[model samples]
Target: MTSKNNPKAFPLNLPEGDAELLLDELQTRLREGRRLFAEVGQILAEIESRGVRDLYGYNSIAAFYEHVARVPRAEAQRVTGRALALNSRRARDGTTIDPVAPLTGESASTGALAEAGIDRIVTVMKRLPDHLDADERLEAEKGLVELAGVARPRDVTMAGTDLLARHDPDGKPKDDPEPKRQRSEFWLRQKRTGRWDMRGNLDPETGARLNALLVPRAYPAPGEVADDRAPAERRGDAFAEIVDLAEAGPDIPAPRQTAERVTEEPQPAQPSEEPASRPKPTQMPPQGRQSPYRGSGEGVQESAATERSRNVAHLRPPRWWARLSRPRSGNAAQPHKPLTA
Candidate 1:
């Protein structure tokens, strides 16, 4: 009776057929998932090996990200950093770790690709201090290998390297274009990147001085106004404005003209008659009133002679051959001694 009263309820378990079916399905799913994961791991590793060589040219973690891995340049950078950290750990302890294994969802952990990309970028930064910024260098290393997993890192780096090589410190490219001997301007195009470059042939000092003057004109001083004058008129006005600025600019002190003292010969006075319509001038410009540049125009010949002296000063024979180069100047200081027998 007690068994009959208990028997109204069945055992709280699945029917055997359904239980077996559920177990089979779970086992199948698990096996498939493992297979998929392992497959991904192997593929990523294959990509990384070749990719590293491609972008890095021979061997590099950055290439691994970009080439064999097929990670986009940006994402590859983020992943490369993680790979670097792992490699560093492997390096510190005598352990060898594979970068792609974790990145491809093969290992117990995933998403390390981002970290790997970033770490690789940091390592690359150390290598290319001259060219790349911190973030950009890291990006190059990090993304190269990962990008290779999907596509070819060679393509990515080829494009990137070619483009990057053209930049200078000012973010403009340092131009090494073919000389424009005929024309003043010339352009150079990089075959790999298809970038164009420009060059000019100004001497270094001249270029710097010209830049100093032109930079201000390009970015004019405050209180300057633009005029709708023709190009020639504008240029003339600009010259005049600059002259005025030199004469009385608040920022710069005006330079005084240097005077040359004159050695003069007294000349007999020659008088000229003033014509009927002529008027006397009240004032004259600095040059007309008391000239500093010309002096008295008296010792002009002497000045010319002094310049000649300076010119010949550069020529001299060795002291042992003294008599060979000496020139006779008929002055008491340079008195002629008799030629030695």
Candidate 2:
């Protein structure tokens, strides 16, 4: 009898080694399943099933590869093509098609499948048919979103969305200018297509030089500080200024002027008006019966003093009772009548 702790002369290498061996034997003995052959058979079959004809694109083949064979859509495409190519080469006398390579070709690591996976995906995204149903769009968009995982879609293409967003009102990402990159502010805007519309961002030195070249022409000399303009406006104005400067180079001759052009165009001045001729006459109606104040000197003095007294009484403040009165509470204020002279 073996010692209690002694290892077996022919011990199983690992706990699962027997299981792995069993699985290998089982795989070797098993006949290929109908399901595996079914999908492949359908691909070769001349007659399309009810909706199978609808699925004519390589995409359907891809989906079949993914769902049935447990491979990615991209790998499935490559494998399917390889399988077809291999099948095409054999004598046409009803020879059995090679099945193993097509399925197993996908066994290679996914990282090795395509040099420019992101690029191909972006191309597909751009070309997605606008007429596709909403469901189809969602499915296609899902694939695109996945592609953007490895590389940002915006980096790959910017023309459509970027251009439209700049010109179209609603397409702009926000009312404010797009966020600037940290290294140096470059112009960037989002497109409807979800790619970045990037104009070159100058380095700090280049930006300063460009700005210095642009400022006087684009922005009037007022403000005189870089901080005054919004980055968007500054960029826009700067572009306009650059075009103008390049178009109107330093050596271009100044616009010529003529005396005719310079002469302040004068209009005939308006004529002055003449004073009108008029007649003069004077008459008086005796006020208050040719007052005694005017006729006799002593009476005149007395009369003037009486009038002064009346005028002083009229000009004085409110009467005794009136002086003590105030308005009732909460009355709406009203305008007062003018005092009689």
Candidate 3:
């Protein structure tokens, strides 16, 4: 009986020798599949170049492959990409030279590399700078091919990465600062209960600045020598202090100016056959003498003292109320009159 790890164990229903034979056959088939995959890429590229899609009434080669060959859109793109990168063979004299992709395509045809290994190597090559001279690319490809012969796909990927880093220590195809800015964000969302959830991924510089400002405040105050606050509690307090300090800062912005309403020119009032008439306000009669103890409006008469007692008698009288209580000019000795509506 063969151990579970043995190749013979794969074809469980077969004897050891037969199972071993089947395993060998499967390995052979896998190699052939990879080689055929590479060839398919070449065919796909030719189809694209010839505008075969127009003849087939398909929008794109990928779409065609999606329907006809059942290949996914993404996988089709990958296959075509590999084809262009690996199958091209041309010299300055227009004569065909050896195909490129020494690591992936060449090795795949020879049954020395699997699809995963090929993919890894291809991915590494793709990430390399387009400005790389032919010689540099060839050397890199050669190194990866040699490594792939004995290493797993993951190891090949790592090896390729190391090679790339060594070749371009600063990292290739130099990135713009814009994408980093785009990746950074801060979010604050209000929950149904009126509380907020604050979350953010900040740039290194901003994060460092915030950390520097808050870290000191997060520690117990000098006066509270035996503080027992948890780290989170301390941090929360520190954050509150930071917010207060920010509020106190002079950099607080003035409120934004509202957009001015766009006023259209008023249309000239069309001359009317009859001019609009204005209504005159009714003239009010001069009040007869008002009693000092009674309010101006219609109501039961109450002495100023009595009114005050009903309200805030202990409070000093308002200036206007005091003036009203004092005898008016020319009415010093007038008898009090009952109020009327």
**Which numbered prediction scores highest in TM-score against the true structure?**
3
Over all chains combined, what TM-score does candidate 1 have? 0.23
Tens digits of per-residue lDDT for model 1 on 1-341?
A: 34545434334444556877778766666556655544443444444544544545636454555665687877655445444433312333455564422223322133222323333333333334364565654455545545533444345445445444543324444679997655334343433343223356666676787566644443322334543445444434343334433433334432222231123333454457745332222221222111122224424743554344333322331121233235555653664443321
Give Cα distance to truth, residue 115, candidate 3, Å. Answer: 1.8
Q: Cα miss at 195, model 3 (Å)?
A: 34
What's the TM-score of each model vs. the native? Answer: 0.23, 0.25, 0.45
**Clashes, model 3:** 0
Report the number of the highest-lDDT candidate: 3
Alpha carbon lDDT of residue 56, candidate 3?
88
Model 2 TM-score, 2 decimals: 0.25
Q: Which portions of model 1 show Cα errors greater than 4 Å?
A: 1-60, 86-240, 243-341
Segments of candidate 2 deviating more than 4 angstroms: 1-24, 29-71, 88-226, 230-232, 244-341
* lDDT measured at residue 27 in model 1 versus the true structure, 0 to 100: 61
lDDT of 3 by residue, 146-255 (tens): 88878888899899889878777777455565643346678766565644567899888899999998798677644425666777767766675565445334454433
